[model samples]
Target: MPLANLLTSLSALPESGSRDAYLRFLKSAGDAALRRSGGPEHVTGSCFVFSPEFDRVLLCFHRKGQFWVQFGGHIESEDASVAEAAQREAREESGISDLVLLSPGIMDLDRHDLHAGFSCSAHWDVGFAAATAPDVEVSVSDESEDVRWFPINEMPIQVPAGFGARLERVRHAAMSQSGTQIG
Candidate 1:
């Protein structure tokens, strides 16, 4: 049932290479892709958490990747939909439970190769955007060494490949979807 929800969500996204690829993966891998043990690639959910003002983005210094990145992880059986998975990850990793999804549909999709230390060779990441209240405190989860908010213009150097562009896309989507000014 959750996989069906994911499929519906992905299907609703506008046509794009990333969307196409995710559809293909789901068609071929079925529910297996939702689990980490699903071959070498699996679906994961992540969120670019923005401040109430939308000028700052929350990032975690991933312990394994050693880079500042958005909060996310593998989909679990408990997740009812991909967006819910993203929200769950954001809440767990950022320690901010009041995050609101910026869009009803996913904002971005990224398939990236993993480092050697990871169990999976790649992650087909479903990306979303969320906003948190001003002055909410963040506590770093066990997956990260640090969790902090950074200005949208001054992101940290140690980040995943293509993270800057990804953030820009997600930011635009978040702003437009939420009817917030793209300041």
Candidate 2:
């Protein structure tokens, strides 16, 4: 099957973060095109920073179509751990200080279909965490048009399908681990 067809099939499935299903899908999709391409899997991580004062989560509106998303990007070769890569990306992208890692390490994993002329897979291992005493200084980088906190309930409608559930799981796990109630 062509990479486009595989992507279409993957995209149609519910984004439930099921590892077994995803691995099986990848294996059956055809002999590891990702490995054969001789390029990294395009790993990325992001912190879902939440502020009690605003009762919202910090998000970045990406420049491409202004999609609201957390801070993350491709993993550099120097990075020893995915969590560290996520932390670095968040700080570099958002310029926020005193960010905290909420989850154990990696929080979510998914394969993104880059629909450029030829399709390629970008595997993401998202890391979740909270920010402390954010400085509120907005810096628009190449990746994002704007960065700000949004009330969780009033978040933009651009979020991808089934992302809400994944966010909730991360939130619940973080809250439970931190001994904080999900207000």
Please report the candidate that would top lDDT against the real structure.
1
lDDT of 1: 0.89
How accurate locally, in lDDT, is each candidate?
0.89, 0.59
TM-score of 2: 0.70
The residue-by-residue lDDT of candidate 1 on 78-151, one tens digit each, is 88877888999989999987776877588889999999879899999999998886579889899999999899
Worst 10 residues of 1 by lDDT: 97-106
Q: Superposing every Cα of model 2 onto the true structure, what RMSD results?
A: 7.5
**Clash pairs (backbone) in predicted model 2:** none
TM for every model, in the order presented, reads 0.95, 0.70
Model 2's alpha-carbon lDDT is 0.59
